[model samples]
Target: MAGCFDVMQHNASFDWDTRRNTYSAIFAGFLFFFAWWLVIDTAVVFTPTGDWNNWYFALAVSCSLSMFMVNSVSNRALEGLYSEEGVLGVKGTRIWLMFGFIGSFACIIAGIWIMFGDYVLQKNDNPKWPGVAIFLHTLLTFIASLTYKFGRSEELWD
Candidate 1:
């Protein structure tokens, strides 16, 4: 048992320098899990009896995941921005970065709009848990991406 535990610990160990990456990944995982939970809860537990549309919840999940992917890809591209020898010119890199940021921002805005227009404004007396969950998921995705980006830095913020 001790031997097995030691092996497991060794495999799970992460370098201190990459702790931020681990944390951001964990946060992303939690966000995805919560999003899934929200969807399932809405479907199984809180079956909408009114004229509620399911598209809003779906859109929220899609937007959150899409934002995360775009931000990650753009961040990887931006890493090559300062490289003078790269095939992608600095101008191209900047363009990609700008597009990625815009897409991410758009996703957040869309999530908010869905939450407000679908759940908040509805005339139902049902709990607004789904909308709240989606909004939190979108916000957490944004935060996780920012954490991944800034966590790469080793400098102390003075």
Candidate 2:
């Protein structure tokens, strides 16, 4: 909310510019959508199930909706860092990141456990094709976003 930031800034006696404020909100919206594109949309490729498990797509759509919520909360937070107002904090944004981080990890862990499961079941002759490698690769893309910035913001200068 603008008031939240306004209250904080006013209490600190810092002058906030309306132009910068406008830009920050706009930038937050941009990053929220971009992050969805990079992370959630990528996840969708893995879920082609015809049923409701189409959640990967739902997640992507929800991430887009949250863009507005994130802007309403205040935009600057989403522009640069991973703090509260950041794109990462928006409900959908946070969910997608979690899905990518935890969901991907769960898939990887399951794949590994399956390998052991197969071994114990005396199916050792079976190839180690649990699909773990693919899951890991997807998760790594998310991690890569941390080191590599991929969105544009008015605050960012070349």
Stretches of candidate 2 exceeding 4 Å from the true structure: 1-92, 119-124, 129-158
Scored against the true structure, residue 51 in model 2 reaches a CA lDDT of: 17
Best by lDDT: 1
Judge candidate 1 at residue 90 and give its lDDT.
55
Which digits, one per residue and each the tens of the lDDT, describe model 2 over residues 1-158? 76676556334443334344444445544544455455444345434532113333343343333333322332243333544554446665545544544543454454345435532355435333223333333334333332223232335431
- Per-residue CA lDDT of model 1 for 1-158, tens digit only, reads 66766556346666766465666667766766665676566655555564346666666666555555555444445555344536656567667556656766777787787678767988867667666766766676666566555555433221
TM-score of each model, paired residue for residue: 0.62, 0.29
Quantify all predictions' global Cα lDDT against the true fold.
0.62, 0.40
Ten contiguous residues with the weakest lDDT in model 1: 149-158
How far out, in Å, is residue 11 in model 1? 17
